[model samples]
Target: MEGHACPHEDILETMRKLLVAAALAGCALSPLTAYADAPGQSPAEKADPAAREISADQIEATVQFLADDLLQGRDTGSEYYDIAAAYVASRYRAMGLTPGVDGKWMQDITFRKASPAESTLAIVQDGKAKELELKTDFITGASFTDQLIDMSAPMVFVGQGIHSPENGIDDYAGLDVKGKVVVVVSGAPKGVPGDVAATLSRGKTKVASDMGAVGMISIRSKSAMESLPFEKLVGYIEGHAEKWVAPDGTVVVDAPNLKFSTYLSPEAAADLVDSSGHDLSALLDAYESEEEDAVRPTGFVIPGEVKVKAVSEWEEVTSANVVAVLPGSDPQLADQYVVMSAHLDHVGNHLWEAGEDEDGEPKDTIYNGALDNAAGVATMLEVARVIAENPTAPRRPILFVALTGEEKGLLGSEYMAKYWVREDGEPVGVVNFDMPVLLYDMDDVVGFGAENSTMGETLAAAGAATGIGVTPDFLPDENLFVRSDHYSFVKEGVPALFLMSGVENGGKEAFTNFLKTDYHGPGDDLSQPLNWESARKFALLNYEIVKLTANADARPMWYEGNYFGDKFDPEGPRAPAPAEAAE
Candidate 1:
């Protein structure tokens, strides 16, 4: 016993000296630092003892600073966003974490922002051309490159335009859409799983492009309209699309084959399909129906040809993703990483003069994304602090990432998922915190993408430890599972979970109200009343999850027969279904 001094004693002694030095220097001590002041605590008691004692004041302070008007919404590729990235780096330095991005605190990615300069669409029927009006009938979009598009092709009707053979439903099955423009109804059938549906819905353009389609025309069903109306879509007609560029200055194009793409209003779509023997209204209704056996159309050749053209303008910009790491105590498992991520960027200022509105009153144009994502970054930082400050480190390294360009269509996260490689190893699992609206005291949390992987069990354990319940998605139609930065990691075969403030104990009302009033708008600022207690609990829950994941014996795996696992990560390890996982 004389020769076997405990390892943690040395760390404790060092911490005590640091605390004394900090006290003498008049520097503020964190909650974990204050907790460590106790004497004679055993090594077992010192390990992650403050995981549940996350400080609400610290979380609020981070949020207040990030969401302040001085930051100017932290828009990606802007000087203000660079300032935010530097702040996050400073926080990582304060926590004593090493830089995760190849000895740098940030990974600066080059991106190309492209918007349509001139776009035109026309419907050709009975050998006659009818030029449709832009911004009224359809709007060209999703083209990330500066290109000239002039294509006149035959039209095909691909019901949902989803090509997921693993899901046993490919809208393109038995269809000859090669070199043709395909008209697609937005939203998947009600029978499809939520996560699958969300991914598939977004993948329509990529599928069309891959299938050699020359052009794409999108129309929304009633259900899709209920979620995202055409009017709301029109607001985004003048695009601000951004895509990461390679080192060679080549812009990334997800749907390259598609020279033209447009989303039609319901009226325009109805008119296009009226003479094709298929009633658009009936098909939309069938797609939205809840009946077990409903009429869902497969692909068909519509009796029409379409002509479209587009010209785009482009500019290049650079943005950074702030990254830090807490090295593992166990050298054997230290190479593998457990990643915790939250987006650091938000939509920029609105189109308006700050000094006056149309009515001669002061206007607020800055989109201060307080609850949209400043809160999420704050929560991630709090978790990082707790984990980094713990006396005992997890067996596996933990990566803390504050990603930029999330507002620009997940460009930052997509870049990281595709290009950011660690010399040690790949990430074992990812926990993404995005837009946890903590407007009220919540009793539960929604774990998106949980059912698809083994992380569900970790989430349950973490929620239980933090005195919160695991709740199902209350607003399923929103397709939130695929909306955030986590989906980018998922696309790269990483098992990930996205946590959202649940719709329980007035949470539904609060979340709904926030979305209606403040989401992506100038209203998401510090003036709103936020429940700091809930923010503390949310941070604690995510920290517990991160700790459990990093310390687990086996890496997180996709459930056997899971659609996402089978489709995206076919070769990764597999686990039993969640119902049988424990056994």
Candidate 2:
């Protein structure tokens, strides 16, 4: 303690420091002290729940049935999807768990599908207005904004929309974005991880709003178009019905600050940039041209207001979120709830099978998202069952949620995070299970958002219980943190973690291959190789985490200087960690 100074060193780092002292004292390293969670130790041992109640057979059976093609990929708006919900509800009723939402197992989530009836992007050239075609030139969208958006704001193009001071990069440097609409590309620099870059892109909206900007315009650059083919990109955003989150229903707080936002086509973006005397192609080339300078400041400032008007038509539809509760045993701790969540929806069936394989056979049309989420849901059900069936309940209540419309941009989880409240009403933490591809044995788990709070420690302890290790996010650039249900909770000022079967033990290869060979395709069915034993371990690990977070005498707190906590929960970093935890 006298020699160490850093308070944030992990267990291994602390050990390394200790080793230095041991050599000074001329002592051999004690094996007992070497292990963080020894076989038998006070406060450092595994709180392994009797996981005998968790059955591998049941897990496999549940996964097989849910991911089966007969369910028609369990699309969110289809009858098959409703059938899946009913099945989950039935299981909740049978498990003796109480309804989490009011007095019912279902939390009715209403969604408004918005489609642009008419969209126009016009510019005042020499005080004369010119209109740009809707789909051909640009695709203006406002699923959350009013049915109509009319704005004549100035424009600024930010590279990757990054503004991290630590990274020595600021796309909006030396510019004022107040009362302006900032245009940005759809991606980050090449070296930046997709998750981190995407997260930076998300922060760009907030940065602009804080800077007093009115709106945003995202133009898919040439690099973006090449990275994701034009046809595939258009197909994704071309759907008439975009799941629109209500102002009060969304986890994205910055979306409301924007008056209008749209995606401009390459030709359309070129037209806008030409007025600034900068070639759109040259700007894109700058991003790819220099490796060290992943992104360079596009110093071109285009003058004049480009009026954006979007008129949309919407239809309301309803979906159900299956929620159940295992009431805590301890009265004091029962007030706080630990939520365990997983999405129940998938991409559903393909419109039609157009692609062909090497053998000239038609590609599988139905998107049986076995690993994408059905596996996650099945594991959630198993964890719930095991915990509820236990003789002794945890001190804090455990809320289990099977969300809807996750494929539609995490709609249900965002809805619940905004509306759902614990019976006694105290925030604790969240654990989200998304796609846990268990093709082989996994010794570690990658937590997407665990660094924000004590959820990181909880995951470590839970991993120790099952001889599994916890690793930091390896794909931070993918923006994996905000891509799932847990992020919805995070935005509401809750510390949360998104767990995935890690990329250890050839998991890198296994997971990568699974993505290429099966992900969202019909191949994500029963025929896909799944490790039932791995699934069992994962469920057990989930159980241990629930017990750890729910039964601990103390509430989970945000770690000091967590990047996410500082942004979402401002007051969190102000609190000091325990002195004993310091180096």
- Model 2, which residues run further than 4 Å from truth? 1-49, 122-124, 127-136, 148-153, 158-180, 188-197, 206-214, 221-223, 241-253, 257-259, 279-300, 307-309, 354-363, 573-583
Please report, as a residue range, the 10-residue window in candidate 1 with the lowest summed lDDT.
Answer: 20-29
Worst 10 residues of 2 by lDDT: 23-32
Go through the candidates in order and give the clash count of each.
Answer: 0, 8
TM-score of every model versus the real structure: 0.90, 0.81
Over all chains combined, what TM-score does candidate 1 have?
A: 0.90
Residue range 399-496, candidate 2, lDDT tens digits: 88999999888888887887774547755689888999889987788877665577777888777667778876666635677899988888778888
Model 1 vs truth, CA RMSD: 9.2
> How many Å off is the CA of 168 in candidate 1?
3.1
Candidate with maximal TM-score? 1
